[model samples]
Target: MATIHKLIALALAFTALVVVVSPATYKEGDPIEHKSLTLGEVLDGDRMAHSLYDIKFRTDVPSKKVLCNVKYTEKMLDVLRSAIEDLYYFEFVLDDIPIRGFIGHLEEGGFLPHNHKIYLWAHLHFNIEYNKDHIIYANVTTKDQLPISLDGATTPMELVFTYSVKWMNTDLSYEDRGTRLRDNSFFPKNLEIHWLSIINSLVLVFLLIGFVVIIMTRVLKSDFARYNIEDEEEADDLDSDDNGWKIIRTDVFRFPPNKNLFCAILGVGSQFLALATGILLMAMAGMFNVHRHGAINAAAVVLYAFTSSKLG
Candidate 1:
């Protein structure tokens, strides 16, 4: 009874520990806290753009070039139309570019075709120029405009704007991947320390969980041994008799096992083996620095029927 209690307590404690530790190790929140938008979504379109006026000066370098692109949805057509019609420049303060782009409206195909839902698309360009000391800095801002309107808006608008920027230092060498393709010299430096700190915290949590598990397992084992009673021992000894085995054989094996139990055990075991093997192969490939193209899951079953033949 004591051993059973200890085992139950150990299981409960381990479960509780896992629940607490696992959450801390891996937690994902809004990439941009105030403006719940990812880098990709922010670049997608401006109408959908979250109101993030200040590009919190994370990190940047003059020598190391950085490029940024902004895209706006069709809804932005109204804003642009109002800007162009007003003649007064709707000043958009860009921190990095150190300037603003004056927007305007034009006829269909004046910028690009009025596609499925888009009124038009615009592009903005930034080229780096240097001061007298040859210290490179963004020197020019090129404003490209598209004229358009949106269906969802209560009023008519023109020119939806979307822009992409790319910057490269002639001085630096770097590899190009889908993500993190910036020159390390200019890469957001502050984020490096912050992300590393998060990683270290996760590692510490994992180690603490391991230590807790070890200590709890050892303590429970000792406790169980100390409190184990004598009556259950005698019962177990009696249950080990030869007649017990005979009774089990007659009651269970005599029926050749229930079909449901046989199928369940066989099916579950086979599936588990197959799944474990697949996971092992995938893990091995990943460990060896191999990229997994895809995963394959398979299931198979064979059925057979038998007939007896008799000879006279």
Candidate 2:
């Protein structure tokens, strides 16, 4: 009975380990929480009546189909009337967006009415100003207001949508490059090849190489190989000499064991995984931005220190 209990415990532990290591599918709009602090600001309150808004929310990184709608009473400013149309495109930056997370269809993501309603009350505010020389200043503010409804319970989720509006020829210019880059950057872009496929391919390649080395070593060291094959002249010579013992294949004994090569390959592969994961974590911490000149190196070193704990 004790032995059976031990076996059961071992089996459970092995199963848990397998599941933890396995790669699983994670789509955009999945209920992942944002890890970084978020901030947004509205700039340029007047001149052609421009408005800018920035919002930061704890949300699933790179959410699919981020629906943003601006609601305000229409007033005298003509530019404000056509604010969504005249100004430059809205900029939505995903802070710490997972490198492997991708955007997909809402139905494909399995978001229900309850989840959609959580974002219903969230909105951005646009305050525009027009100056004498046809210069426009826009200050967009974000606000949260729940619609009155007696029937349903309010959603528990807290959401922040960080955004900034820039109106200029340069802002318009970025539309092509920025939109193109953003669209291509997400994970599952090749929707057919999921995370499971990549992980499985790596695991299978490693296992095949390991097994081949193990099998070849075992086969070369076995005694049964001595009787299996020999050139015709060698066999005849053996018989003529009346040698009772069979001659082993010389090819099998010719080479020494290459355990070092096998061990080195395995060890390097494990280290490569650790290094790759650490680099990604540091990148997400915003320590290695090409534009950030101040203390970037220091921040990266500190982040590396924290990640090094895992290796030890």
Candidate 3:
């Protein structure tokens, strides 16, 4: 009975610690206003000329009211009309932090032309951070979508915007902040990966290397064994005329015209190869700092310059 009471007390204490460490609390904001939606000026160019539908949706809830907007261009509209897929951009503000993201369909594949009026819904996702004193930092997350066309409709197309907010009890890191800002400004939703094509190329390369290695090994072994045979008959029959490589054996091992230059070039090439391999391995191991692209690029340039100094 004493042990059981102690176990119950321990469990309650652990639960209290967890609640104090990370508490989950959230407040849903009001629905975004429609009048905030505005249109930007349209420019004319071959493919560059375009106009955008600026969606300025605002929400008044939580501690303060925040506004988010996205731009949908004519090119995007045309793509939807042509049954092609695309993602549209939108920017919004939460706690004075500008979050940018895309507005896309939940389903995969391109949108088809519809004879009747269709309703396009906008889904919004907010990534929120919960810190001390119930402070919350929120931002939008977006995904890619295909272009949508609603032509030849009896009535105007209706765009209904829906939103969901997710919260976690953790302080935002520098990387998280940088990523949110960068993604809102210049990032797109879709990342194309051609893994199949890459795999096929790698397979071809390995096959070619294996073939060369096998052929070279067999030829070298045969030539050395034939030339160095203990049997006098076999050695005599394998003459210089029969083995053309044996005739130029001395030249093959001879030094190049500029020995110093050759050595310097070889050393430089070796250093570069080593550096490249080291960097690749480190990247694969996730050793580099994320969101420090400028630092990484500067370090690479300095290292390359230091290594190239060996050429002098």
Candidate 4:
């Protein structure tokens, strides 16, 4: 059985290595522009597999480059019109990283013939971050693009496509690159961490803990006084007086009717609380290295397995 287990584990490790994605390569300052331009709807959907349109790039230098000039034929104009009407966006791949681009806008509340003015986007911008000799991160944005309106020439117009590249030196480690990107582009404004909100939460947690300790301490003090009084007076007097709480004999300390269920619930709660504390301590001791690609979750799962095995 142990031999079989080892073989299975080896097979799983081999499978993982086989399916692992190779990191996209980028020379010191040079970024590779993929030939295929993936175009799709604003939301995630199927994109084009091949390069539908011919795009030429002149790599003059890493800093600036003339991307391409597209002469639109009747068919190309139809495609552009459909994409604009359907709110489709084209994506440019640099270093195997995709950046979304907004093509143009279609006039609403007008007849098809009246909305003949075609606004075409011409420029593309790329921001690449590198650490000394290695490219750490790259992002391409076509947002807030100023379009050149081809007003009169509606049939087949030639559009000159241009692009600009900017390289920035970054001090961030590789593991923190994903976090920086998410915090910059993806994180919602309203959900951002505010100092005021954090302060409020910390105060609230302390207040709750203090309240529980104070309340429990005061309640048990009276019970301790009652115990001393019972020793002097008859014990029957304490048994008859069931109005208030007592830590030893009252309802607060009594065993629940469904004792098994109560024990199970209490045990599970305690285990989870201990598990959380263990994870917190590990993090404080610098156990959490990578914050991306489920590294933290993987660590948590392994810790949970060991803790659970010991408990069992």
Candidate 5:
């Protein structure tokens, strides 16, 4: 009986390894909290506004919830009005997923007047995706809202916010989940050929090269004929008629103004060129990460900082 049990355990381990099936017990975590939101005034992180979450725990989850009504004064309404005009988006952070919602969507992202009836997002549906027993992703979608007129309203208006939570089971790993989120990924997956974009790019390149080659060949052919002129008088005539790129020969060959600045620019360009080449070579050789952009950004930062003295 012990030998039979050993055989069963060995069979299970072999099957797991062959099928690459990942199985684990679910560990319940503390209640979800801290649903913060933020607005980025500038692209800079320091120039931003944050509304930290004031979390509350409840037992009767009751998928759909009516947290409370928020009373907004005219001043608050004006702030939101400006946000809508600027087409700002609200971003919230869940455990691992980053949720982004537009403050409000307008046709062609048009601005609305205060006198016009405006609608605010009142309900949100939170969809949580889990694999095996671990929460992997969370997403929110705006569902329903009623239009409220803010024209000539003296009383404080109530902005009711409600939310619902739902869980979904997935059979994907962490990496697969992330790639799936990037639905329109730029990279070629599984060595698949992107024939459409590739053909378009190739045709465009050939057209551009054809124009440049034809034009340059004609210009250089005339230049060559002038240079090889046997008659001195005719040669002077051809040189005098130098109108296109030939006219700038002396200027292009001469030293540029601001020698220091020119040298600095050249050095910086060369440094960056070298840096880019190195990065591409390393990336192709599997030095950096495959999908995570943070890795690329971190590599670029370190490389730029170290090579700044030489490049800049």
Candidate 6:
């Protein structure tokens, strides 16, 4: 009985150690308290009117959406009515830190039509940095619209915002300074490909290559062996109306019409294949900056154009 009790204690200790070593999975914690957000006073700077778009946390009982509540002054409404461009600035407090952002025109168009509800979409960009289960800070800016009619009547408009958050572990033992978010950049700049994804892709490529190799080596070799044997055995029987691929041997080697066009197409295809392989190799080597999508696209276009000479 004493031995059994000792075994149970050891098992419990081992289980606890396993749990401690495992990575943690996070889910959205309780709707972050709305009381944590405080709206500041609105001010007009150089005829540019600014106001807070009070953010509210609605319970799941009704629906899951962040509601914005803002009061507009008559002068502000008048300015929005005639103004060609305007931006509303505001800030909110979170965890005793102030997060600043702005809302303004998202596009040249003043309104967006959706399901009979004329809406204006807002571009909400958050400048935030995160440390795993530790420190999270964010600043937000929006390109949202306030609907106003030519008649000067205030129209009810909905502000739609989309955002994403990236977290990092800042514990000194595992700190990655490159992954740290910058204040000037709204999006995380670190580009990392998970080892699992890379391994899966490599496995798929190897499987496909192996399949092709087997088909070419084993299957084709067997077919060629059988065909050659038939040719030898039926050398004299060939003219006796036996139909096989040997009958079209002459036609199989016949050149296609418009040989120049065909050769050009083959050359272009080979060039493209080489270009694709080089691009893939470069990507694997992390030679290109993945954070700058525009730069990558421009580089691809330039490379393709430069390699076009091989198409000849």
lDDT value for model 1: 0.33
Q: Tens-digit lDDT track for model 3 on 136-210? A: 345655442223434443332333334454556667554455454544544555875689998999999999999
Residues 1-312, candidate 5, lDDT per residue (tens digit)?
Answer: 011000000111222121111011001132212212222211112111122122222212335565445566667667555555555555444433445555554433436643344445556665667676555666667754543444455657665556666667788787576665555333335666588998999999999999999999998888778777899998777656546666688898899889899999898998898778878887778665433324555666667777887777
Instruction: Give all TM-scores, in the order shown.
Output: 0.25, 0.22, 0.40, 0.45, 0.54, 0.37
Q: What is the C-alpha lDDT of each candidate?
A: 0.33, 0.32, 0.43, 0.49, 0.51, 0.39
lDDT of 2 at 221: 52
Candidate 5 TM-score over all chains jointly: 0.54
Looking at candidate 5, the ten consecutive residues that score lowest on lDDT are 1-10
Off by over 4 Å in 5: 1-60, 105-116, 144-153, 184-258, 275-299
Model 6: per-residue lDDT, tens digit, 160-254? 33332223333432133223323344335587569999899999999999999987787556445556665655655444444555567899899
Strongest candidate by TM-score: 5
Q: Which is the better candidate, 3 or 4, if ranked by TM-score?
A: 4
Q: In model 3, which runs have C-alpha deviations exceeding 4 angstroms?
A: 1-185, 188-193, 236-244, 301-312
lDDT of 4 by residue, 25-107 (tens): 11123333232322212122222222212222221124334444445556556655555666555543433334454566555
Quote the RMSD, in angstroms, for model 1. Answer: 23.1
lDDT of 5: 0.51
lDDT of 1 by residue, 49-93 (tens): 121121212122323222222233344444434444443222122
Q: Report, for all candidates in order, the number of backbone clashes.
A: 7, 24, 11, 0, 0, 1
Error of 5 at 90 (Å): 1.1
Off by over 4 Å in 6: 1-178, 181-248, 290-293
Question: How far is each candidate from the true structure, as Cα RMSD in Å?
Answer: 23.1, 23.6, 17.0, 12.5, 14.6, 20.5
RMSD of candidate 5 to the truth, in angstroms, is 14.6
